[model samples]
Each structure stands twice: as structure tokens, then as C-alpha cells.
Target: MSEDKSNRVVSGRVVSNAMDRTISVLVERRVKHPLYGKFLRRSMKLHAHDADNACNPGDWVRVEQCRPLSKTKCWRLVEIVEKAR
Candidate 1:
């Protein structure tokens, strides 16, 4: 049996460029402040694999944890959640 255990990393689309075979995914999460006790927006930039180069801006995509594709890319494009309208 294959032995691969990795947690999936999901993020929203902040920018998608097929020309460079990469997509800039924006992940947003809520975090409570230590002293303020209020939720704040926390965003992160992630690079995902785009084999077919089929992705555009403003598209929700799900990325799974995988080997590093580039220096800062450790996720692969699993599927597009919603297409840009």
C-alpha cells in the first residue's frame, strides 16, 4: 500500500495565471486577538500546481498538500470550486 499522509490545504483564488503554470491562491482564516478578543482576517499566499493551465482570476479552488513544486509551492490544484462569473 502506498504510504502518503498529508493534510489538504484549501484556499481561495486571489490571482490565477496559466501562462506561468502557477496560481496564486489566497487563504483567509479568522483569528482571535490575544488581548482584543476580536476576530481578524488573516490571509496567506500559496502556489498551486496547474497542469492543464486551466484557471483564472476570482475562482475558488481547493488545493491538496503535496511535494513542493517550487521554492514556495507545496500544494497542488485539486479542483475548481466555483468559476468566475
Candidate 2:
């Protein structure tokens, strides 16, 4: 089988790195409210596999969809977009 390079990628901030080889990322998106038509922020917490455990809380990272590595990990860290300031 061929690996799909077009997997979905999401950019978010690392929220937690307590778990071994795993990190929690908080992805946020702005969407317009259907009724009020006002843009509102929506965020989701996703578990991602960080093989090197190099990510830290508050760091921006890009995660790509991948085969499930664990119960809650279906995404893997692609790269560290920005280091924590």
C-alpha cells in the first residue's frame, strides 16, 4: 500500500505532555454563528503521538492524521511550528 501524503494536518498548541510519547494539543477554529453571524472560537483537544517527546506545553505544532497508535491517538506530530516563548 502507498502512504498517503495528503493526510489531514492541523496546527495547534500543545496543552499537555505528561503522557509518555504523547501530547495533548488544543486546536482552535473560528466559525460564524448560524443565527448571529458572529465569528466564534471553537477548540478541540486531541491526543497526538510525539515519538521524541520534544514538544512542550504552549508550543505550536502541526499534527497529521495517521493510523491509531493507541486508544486516543490517531494523530502524530508532524513538526514543531513554533517554540514556546
Residues 1-85 of candidate 1 have per-residue lDDT tens digits of: 9997768767687485744778888899999999999999999888888887888989899988888877887888889989889
Q: What C-alpha root-mean-square deviation, in Å, does candidate 1 show against the real structure? A: 2.0
Q: Judge candidate 2 at residue 55 and give its lDDT.
A: 99
Collision count for each candidate, in order: 0, 0
lDDT of 1: 0.83
